[model samples]
Target: DVRTTFKRMAMNDEETVALTAGGHTVGKCHGNGDASILGPKPEEADVEEQGFGWKNTQGKGHSEDTVSSGLEGAWSSKPDRWNHTYFHLLLNHEWESVKSPAGAWQWEPINMKEEDKPLDAHIPGVRRNPIMTDADMALKMDPEYRKISERFHNDPEYFGEVFARAWFKLTHRDLGPKSRYLGPDVPKEDLIWQDPLPTVDYTLSEVEIEDLKKKLLNSGLSQTELINTAWDSARTFRGSDYRGGANGARIRLAPQKDWVGNEPERLQKVLAKLEEIQQGLDKKVSIADLIVLGGSAAIEKAAENAGVKIKVPFSPGRGDATDEMTDAESFNDLEPIHDGFRNWVKKDYVVKPEELLLDRTQLMGLTAPEMTVLMGGMRVLGTNHGGAKHGVFTDKVGALTNDFFVNLTDMSYDWKPASDSHYNIVERKTGETKWTATRVDLVFGSNSILRSYAEVYAQDDNKEKFVKDFVKAWVKVMDADRFDVKK
Candidate 1:
């Protein structure tokens, strides 16, 4: 549990060891009293105690009588000082399992001298044996952790340095790129997990942007091809960790370029053309900006074909990151096995496809209505993975339209089961398949809340509203990880 939890937080073994030991060095656990007498949690307590939780009425209810984690005693002999006493006591002594007054199992040093024990927090002239929890003991017992523990014991200076860096990472990692960090205390060096990007060397004028868009459209790539490549590049963003987005242009790097969900062959073709266009221009433009620009241009063209004539918002200044800036191995966890937005599932899973869709949507920080609009728009724009026609409900496949929601809510078609993951929409009168569908496609019209959103797009007057909402959602996904670009 300790190893896995730390790994997800982007900590390595050495950092994990430093953080755990350094954190426990000064704090003493309080479990000297019976835990059964504790009051209800703050939220569940009476009106008077609403903001205060776990009140203990026994004795003074604090100090010597306090109970937390049901374990007692400190890890270091000199508990108030910043020293290597934790490493000293852990390595020098033999320990035995013992229970605190609260009945929780913990480890205590056996046959220890009186002077080596920690002084009681509240009582003068009283000393108690130092204690260790199961997690603390694991550092001494686990072979890999034991080696790191021994190193810290030998060199206190290196141990302190490592612990400080690890502490900084644990606190500031979710704050996005170091560019967003203000104040003088922020560190000078950039870490790989920060997903750092180079400063934008040049800015493009509006005329230059329009010229590049024209070149991208004339590069012989279809509207679906341009949009899908950009979507695939941007879809890896996780608002949770503030990592993986189009700003780094990491889609061209290893792991991501080679991901099966990205459709590598098609990706290479789009990138090749985009790079070629980039080489011909006199002004410098990052492939990161071009990729997003291509998508926006394609979206505008699609909306124009549908008679909406609205512009898809575009923002430039995204910088391309090199392979050295990327942690290739760490990115394996970010790969999409299933992307419900593009209507692709890499393999079968026990969970329903619609549920997987919701999971991905929430991770991208999108609301339910935004998810619905993006889904309907992607289907009509023919951006389904592998050119799978499962959800391409419109005859005008390359145009941005509300035809997906319209056909979905239309009563003339009967949906039949093609397989567990698929459904076929057949005409009720003639019994001929008009279009194929996936559970992800049918879900919007089937679920009550989603169906309500779907019905709004399906109405005659909301076609322009559908196009505008889809463009808004598309921009949100594209810029989800652009922390360097100011809001």
Candidate 2:
């Protein structure tokens, strides 16, 4: 249970042991009284209690009578001071299961010397056996943890250093890149989990950007390929932790490059061409920037084809991250198991596809309208995963048009389930399949909330609004992780 919890925090085994050991080195757990007499929690407490709860009524509520987690005693001899006594007693003594005064199951040192026992918090010169929770005992019981425990016990200095670093990571991990850190006390060293990217010394001009765009458009790559590659890179961003995004261009690195959802074959081909173009240029341009620029250029081309002349915004500061900067194992969680924007689900899930779409949309910090427009635009641009024609609702594929919403809200077609995850859009009269869709696509028409958004885009007057909103949403995803750029 402890291991699984640590894994969710993106912590390694060594980090996990260090954090737990370091935390327990000081501070004793309080369980002096029977916990059953404790009152409700602070939020649930009565108004007369003045927002304080866990009021122990069995005895004096203060000091020795307090009951919290109900796991009594300190893990170390010096409960108030930081020391190496935690591993010292943990590795040297045998422990047996015992009930705390509050009736919580805990482990206490068996026949431990009185001198080694920690003094009680309230009483003077009265010593008590050091205690350990099941979580603590697991350290010595597990083979791998025992080895680390022995190592820490033998080397206090090494243990201190490891714990210090682990604690720093646990606190600052959600801050995203080192650039986001403020104040004079921030550490100078870069951590791998920060998703480091090389700082670009040179910036590209509009002329230079235009020239690069021209090169990409004439490089024999299709609009779909360019757009998909860029989307895959940027779509990894999660607003929750600010961990993944286009800023590092880590999509070119391991784990991400090999991710099944990225369509590795197509990705490699696009990267090869982008790298070739980068090598030929005198000015330095990151592959990260090229990937996004290629997509912007593709969207612009696609928009022009649809009779709407527009320029998709492009930002050129994104840096290409090397494999060394990426944590490949930890990144497995960020993989696109179900990407509604691309109308792809890697595998069948118990959760409906439409729910998965909402989860992703919220993570990327997109509104319902933005999500709707992006899906509609992605369909017509032919960016579906593996070219699955599941959500391509437009006859004029490769063009940025409102055809997805137009055809989706059109009453002439009937949606029939082809299978659990697939649906066929058949002509009402002819009974001929005109287009195919996933729950992601049909949800816009079937769900009342989403259908309202779809109908707005389907209107003739709102065609231009759909394209503009799609471009705005597309740029939002591409630059989601660009913390260096001020909003």
Q: Which candidate leads in lDDT?
A: 1
Candidate 1: stretches off by over 4 Å: 51-53, 484-487
Residue 176 error, candidate 2, Å: 0.7
Report the poorest 10 consecutive residues by lDDT, candidate 2: 53-62
Query: What lDDT tens digits, residue by residue, belong to model 2 across residues 162-240?
Result: 9999999999888888889999998889899887888788788889999999999999999999999999999999998
Worst 10 residues of 1 by lDDT: 478-487
**Candidate 2 wrongly placed segments (more than 4 Å):** 32-55
Give a tens-digit lDDT track for model 1, residues 1-487: 7888888787888998999999999989989988888999889888888679889887889888889889999999889888789988998999999999989999999998899899998899899999998888888998999999999999999999999989988989888788878998887888997878888879787888889889989999999999998999999988887888899899999989999999999999999999998899899799999999999999999999999998777888899999999988778888998999899989989988899999999989999999999999999999989999998999998899999999999999999999987999999999999999999999998899999999999999999999999999999999888765555
- Inter-residue clash pairs, candidate 2: none
